[model samples]
Structure formats: structure tokens, C-alpha cells
Target: MYKQLLITGGAGFIGSNFVAHWLAQHPHTQVTILDLLTYAGNMANLQSVADNPNLSFVRGDIGDKALVSSLFAEKDFDCVVHFAAESHVDRSIEEPDIFLKTNVLGTHNLLECAKQHWLYPGAKPRTHLFHHVSTDEVFGSLQPGESPFTEENNYKPNSPYSASKAASDHLVRAYHNTYQLNTSICHCCNAFGPHQHTEKLIPKTIHAILSNKTIPVYGDGLQIRDWMYVHHTVEAIERIITKGEKGEAYNVGYNQEKTNMTLIGETCSLMDKLFADNTQLQRQFPEATKAAEGKSKELISHVEDRLGHDRRYAINANKLSAHLNFSQTGSFEENLLDTIRWFIQQHTKVSTIDI
Candidate 1:
């Protein structure tokens, strides 16, 4: 429904995917992508639509107040889909200051800028929205018998990363409540798909199996997390922006629950099957001895858990599905294989560069 849109962190995993999806779905809309190109952000993620005339890439920071305000002055953006953040839990633990700076302060910078431009005093009421893409970790770890995280759940973030996001969510809600700014917060479960950074669980596991390296599992590997396909997350964001009410938060989840061990084992099994079926795979990467021999499971390595590792994370997504009629598509097993193959293709492009 948005016309001229500003998408922060558009080169990151989910933001990049959403950019592609949005351009394809709304061909006439103009999209300006603001990214800092951090280690987790890659320019190659937008390679497919690099030539699209309607898509513009701006290398900048959300925390840069001058630049953000300048963009608002230049473009009459009807929507701001904020996806930028310092999201790695381990990295957040190591350096929480950066997380707070980017996740907390950076988000506030964008909101303040949007409020100034869209809700200016005596200005004509603009048809615009500020959609904040958040994570389910704000609800903290859920017990086995506990209900999935919903919009009504209290914020109980545990990690520095989640705490920062929790602060951002509150800010977005507060802006809506106090200043009457149109905002919607979307809390999505763990997203997995192509072009994701290798530090995440899915990509890390796939990379380990393909390279015949140790697949590290944390502390008994019983930590459960609900996985949502990246495109599904994009769809939820799109639907929320179009159909969802202002000043509301929606939890987007597929209800696909898998423990860390089970997910890794499934990846290993898929790799083994792929190698067994394709002789070229055996020849191309002879180093993948275990995966090619249907023995990738041997690479499973249990490690000590991290500080404040959540036992479980899930989202009900009933509000998203019921209100917006959002439903997940594709088979998880099939999508997992597709994701694994996409990483394999990336390896073929550059041998040493991490995907």
C-alpha cells in the first residue's frame, strides 16, 4: 500500500529478502534502502534487483540524525520499514554498548525523524506508517508448557540484544500512544533462508556439514525455537503494513518448532542425501567427506551454552493469521534443502569468503 518507501538495513538478511519481495509485488513503488554495510550486511544480497530503476541504495546509518532527516526532507516516504539492528546474541553479549547504540538509539533516531516529517505541526495529515520489524526474544524464554508469545505477552528480554530490541519496541509503542504516530511492531520468530550470515544456526549448521566441520550444538541441544521462512516474514510485514491497525504489535510465526539438535540432524541428513544422489558434489568438494558418505551427523559437537541462553522461543502468530489472514507456505523440509543448496551455490562463487 506504500508508495515511496524507506527500508533500513535493506542489505541484511530479512530486509534484503523483503526488498526483493516488495519490488516484485509492488512494481510501481519506489524503495530507498539505507544500510551501513556492516559485517552482517552484504551488497550482494540485492544483486538480483541491482538494476531496478525504482530501487535506490543509500549507504548510511539509521543513527545518523542529519542523514535520516535529510532523506525525509528529500523524499515523501509513505512508509518506513525499519530492519536495522545489532542482532547477534553472542556479539551483543561481548559488546552491549554497540547493541544499545544501534538497536536502541538508532531506532529512536529514525522514529524521531519520521515523526518530525510525517506528523509535523500544522502540516497536512500524511498517509504514512512506521513499521518496526522486531524479534520474539523480547518475550524471553518460554517454558515447555507455556503458551507461545503473543501480542499480549509482557516484555522480558534476557540478552543485551533482546533488551535493546525490547527498548525499541517500547519506543515505537510510546510514539504511537503519545504523539499519535502511525506505527506497527512485528515480532517474528527465528527466520532462515538464503543469503543469511553464517553465524546463525541454520547457515552455520549447513556450512559445517558441507565443509565437513564440527557442527556445534549448545548445552544438550534441547533449546527449541520456532522457525519462519524469510519470505513468510516478509509477507507478514507486508500484510501488517497494508491491513493491520495502527499502534498494534503482531507476532509472526509459522508454529514450526524444532530443537537445536533435531534441526542440525535434519540438515546433516539432507546433506548426506544430496551428496549420495549427486556424483558431481562428491567430486567438487572432496573435503566434504562426511556429508558425501551419509555420515555428516558425526560432525555434531556439543558445546557449553552461552550466557542467558533461552530454553525456548515460540510465537502464536494467531493475531497475524486471524486478523490479516496470513498463512505460511512451502514445506519446511523442502525449504531447508533449498536453503542448503543456495549456500552451496554461494561457496562455488568464492572459496574463502563466508556466505
Candidate 2:
């Protein structure tokens, strides 16, 4: 239980969710968030917890070494949960330098600051931690029958995004081995939940359906991803931070693999049910009456595939499960419904105000 913690990227999807979760579960912990407020980072996501006495929001870049060092010196953070990075693969493909800067150099900056603050000459490693949140794409795409990614899998990142993440992962391991920085890394599969940016697949699909627009599917939309809800992802991270061995990496997943098309279909089915019965939409967005018509399936639009898109990504979580005794409690469908409801409620609120 870290009393004073720094959470980088706390305004983004997973980061913001983790902040809310942490404050709720550990009310005594003080959290300071460092975010650049990039397009993906939205302050609206943290509205529910804006008044949290244990939370402080700072708008800054992790690459700013001076700022990070100052924060570490002032707050004396015992732990750092790094979630700040340029995460979108398509954006990375267009401009890879930002990804390298934020994902690699930004991570390096934080590691250096943490090392200076937490490490001292001729001292055993302290209880302080630097927890790195990463993605399974660092293992590259898995074939149909190939085994899921384990911690031992060779680094074969397929995109600028994944490669940048791979570099950061290596840096974390290097710091642990060479400098003994007392770090732990967890690589998760695709995450879906509330407050996710709409540019992402699940949220974008939901947005298209609700707005009577075409829902674009890249290629055949059969790309497989192990879907972990944001809450479960946070739980896994907490477990790793609390009990995981130093210098080790864990693959965090629930073994729930769903293809792009299947996920879209499930989301559309749920939306149809919600739109038909939602009183908020009837009162606020009568224009959304067509959503209840169940034509969301007709909105499916197959577009060009993502460049160098990985066909499948799965994680072998036997290690995480056996070692930590952790298990995911909710089914994908249950969580997906919960996520869809949140988005609808959010959209309805916005639409109501617009009218």
C-alpha cells in the first residue's frame, strides 16, 4: 500500500480508470497525475472524482525531465504507475517520432527521476516501485494455433506503436537488471470500458451506430484480441504492484478472445436493446429513434485494413493466475453491456444539453 504515488497518464482511458479505482479502494493513498492532455486524454473522464481529496491533477508532459524530477523531489512518490504514452497505432504510423519520444524517452525520464529519488549508494533496493503498464502487441501478431504470449516471448513488435512500447519495456527491464531500479511490468491485451476515446474500435463502433453513420470495419474484421475490461486490468496491476517479484514481467489477461466483427455485432445487439427501451434517449434524443430500428447491423462498412495490422493477439496468463491467484470475475458480455450503457448515458446527456 503506497501512501504517496505518482500516476503518469492519469487522464487517459486506462490511467483515469485506474486513478478512480485506486482512490476508491485505497482512500488513504495520495495520487498525483501527470498528463500532457493529448487528444486522447480528456479531463471529462475524471469528473466523477474531481473532488477527491487524495487526488491531484497536473497538466504536464512526462518527457519534461525537470518537471518530473521536481515532482519526485516534492512528493517523494513511493510508486509510479506509468500509463502515459502515444498509444494509437495509426497515429504512430503517421508520426513515429512522437511515439518514440513519449513511449521511450518519456519512460526513460520517469525511470531516471524515480532512480534518483528512490535509489541511494550502498543501500538494498527500497520498497518503492516503478510499475510500467504496457501492451501485449510487443509480442507481435500470433498465428491461428501459436501459443499465447508469455513473459518469455521474443520481442517482435510489428508497428511503430508496438515497437516504441517494446523499447520502453526493454528499458524497464534494463533498469531493473543494471541499476536495480525495483520495477515490475505488466502487458495487457485490448482494454474496453467507459471513458475510452471514440477513436478506439469499440467506442467508435458504438458511436457510429448511435449516430446513424457507417461503422467501419478494417478488412474482414476478424482480427482477434483478448479483451480485458478496464476494471480487471486495474485489479491485475494492483496485484502485480503488491506481490509481484521485482525485475519480473507479468501478462495480464482473462483469456477472453473476441474478433473485431464479433465484438461489433455484440455491441450492436446491445445498443438495439438499449435504444429501444432507454427513456433518456426518448426524452433527449428522439432523433435517435432510428437506433431502435435495429438497423445497426446495416451500418457495417468494410474499409481498408490497418497497415501491418496484427491478426491475433492473445496472452497466456497461467503465470499471472498461478502466481498471484488472480482471476477475472465478469464475463465479456456482462462488461460490454455495462460499457455500452455508460456510453449511451453519456451521449444522451450531451445531446440533451445541445437541444
Candidate 3:
């Protein structure tokens, strides 16, 4: 076990969850979180573990070479779980330069720092690990009814976000091959869970429905995505970092493929259920009445399709299962229902955010 672990981008939804999960599993381990706290990196996501004795937080950009190097030198982290990047595809379309800098250059800086600190001459074997968290977007879109993406899939990134991630993945591989740095990579499918920013599809839909705003469905809402629960992905990352083979890339997914339309409909149905229950409560107690039990589905609004939007994305998790003894714990339907309940509970909190 590593004495000191550094998790970059630890304030974001996935990173924050990973931190909370890691600390709970390893009480003796010390963790340092470095995050830039961009729009998506919410501090509230980490409030649950804020008071934990084993965790520490740092606010800074990953592209800052001096800051990253200083942290590596000072802390001498034995493992790095890198989750920081400009992740939203829509945002990347609007701003590609920011993606290149933060995702590509920022990763390069961290790799160099790790090389200098952990790859010194005669270093202990497998004493350090630099685990990069990436996405399946790097493989671009799959044809209709095609097989899922695997490690051997060719890189055909269509968006700036994915291209930047591909570049970082290459750099990580290069460092491992040339300098013998212990590195691993896991490309995951779309993730949804609590603490996710409103920019994402599920959260955005929830926010729109709750506030009586239009739920924008890009194009025909036929684009397919393999949705994985956030906790499941985090668990895969933990397993890979601890037990995966260095220099290997693993694909983590829930194998739960759903089109945008199907997902939106499911979300609307759950919201309706919650609203009906609330209405019943109001009837029982007249003073408890708040707002009318309005139908959330009325908010659906079709919008122009995004540029270069992939038609589908799927992942084959055979390697992850074979090597790490891992598999998804729940079906997409089960997880989606749980997610809907969570959103219903958080309606007030999400309503305040600008959709």
C-alpha cells in the first residue's frame, strides 16, 4: 500500500467520489487532492470527507509545472490517480484551446514531474503508479450494432476533448516505454451520479424538469451511450491502481447502452412519480402544500444536434474482469432508478443553478 497518494482533480464529481471511497477503504492511507476548482469542480462534493484526518486538499491548476513539481517533490506520492481534465464534449467544442492546454500539456507536466521523482536510477520495482482516468470517446463513434471498444481499438477521436485525452494517453504510454515509469490507464464509459455538475445530460435534464424549463434534446436524441454508475467506475479505478498490470490500458463500463431519448424518458417517469407522491403528502396536510404537481415531461424541447456527435459508444470489459476480477454491480435500469431518486431529493439544490 502507498503511504502517500495524490489524486489530481479530486474536487470534481468522479474524483471527489474516488477520494471518499479510497479513504473509507484505507483508513491508514494519506491522500492529497490537487484541483483547479473549475466550474465543474465543486467543493461541496467533497464535504462528506472534508473532516477526515487522512485527506488534504490543494487548490491549483494541473498545468502549473512549478506547483505540480513542488508537490511531487514535497509529498513524494507513491501513487497518482489523475482525473482532472476539461471533460464535457459540448464545452470542448466551444473552447478547444483550453482542452489542449489542460488535458494535454497539463498531463505532460505531471508525467515529467513523476518521472523525475519516482523514476530515479535504481528505483524500487513497482513502488509508484501513475493511473490516468480517460474516456471511451477517444475511440470515436461505433457503427450501428458494432462490437464494443477494446484496448486494441484504433484512436479516432472526433472532438477536441477526446483528441486531447488521446494525446495525454499517448504521452503516458511513451513515458512508461522510454523511462520505465509504472503507469496504467482506464477508459470509462459515460458516468452519472450525485455531485455531477448540471452541464451533464442527466443532471441538466433533472434541473430543467424541476424548474419548468425546456429540456433540450440535441438532434433526434438517438445518439447512444454506455452509461456506468459513478461508484462502479471508481471501484474499477481502485482495483486497477492496486492490482492491474503496469503499462496496460483497461476499459471500464456498465455495458448498459441507452439512447438519449430512452434515458430522458426514464428520468421524466421517475420525476413524475416523485411529484405525485409529493402531491399526495400535500393533500394529507394542507399546510405542507408547496407547488402544483406539474408534469416534468412537458419541459422536453428538441434542439439542434451537436457537431461531430458520436452515434454510439460501447465498451467490452473483458480485460478488466479477467485481470481485476471486477464486474458491474447493478443493471442500468436499477442504477438509473436510484439516480432518479437522488435527483428528486436534490431538486431544490439543482434548481438554483443556471441550466
What's the lDDT for all of these models?
0.92, 0.90, 0.87
* Per-residue lDDT over 1-355 for candidate 3, one digit per residue giving the tens place of the 0 to 100 score: 8779989999998999899999998899999999999998988889899999889999999889899889988887999999999998899999999999999999999999899888777776558999999999999999987999999999999999999999999999999999889999999999999888888999988767656678899999999999999999899999999899999999998788989999998888776665565654233323211223545666788999999999999999999999889976777767776776576556544443221
Regions of candidate 1 where Cα sits further than 4 Å from its true position: 350-355
Across 1-355, the per-residue lDDT of candidate 2 in tens digits comes to 6889999999999999999988888999999999999998999999989999889988999999899999988998999999999999999999999999999999999999999888867656567999999999999999999989999999999999999999999999999999888899999989999999999988998788777789999999999999999999998898999889988899998898889999999988887777666665555645555576866788899999999999999999998999999988867889999898788778767644321
Error of 3 at 291 (Å): 11
Candidate with the greatest lDDT versus the true structure: 1
| CA lDDT for candidate 1 | 0.92
lDDT of predicted model 3: 0.87
TM-score of 1: 0.98
TM-score of each: 0.98, 0.95, 0.93
Off by over 4 Å in 3: 122-126, 280-294, 349-355
Q: Model 1: per-residue lDDT, tens digit, 135-230?
A: 999999999989898899998999999999999999999999999999999998999999899999989987887788899888999999999888
Best by TM-score: 1
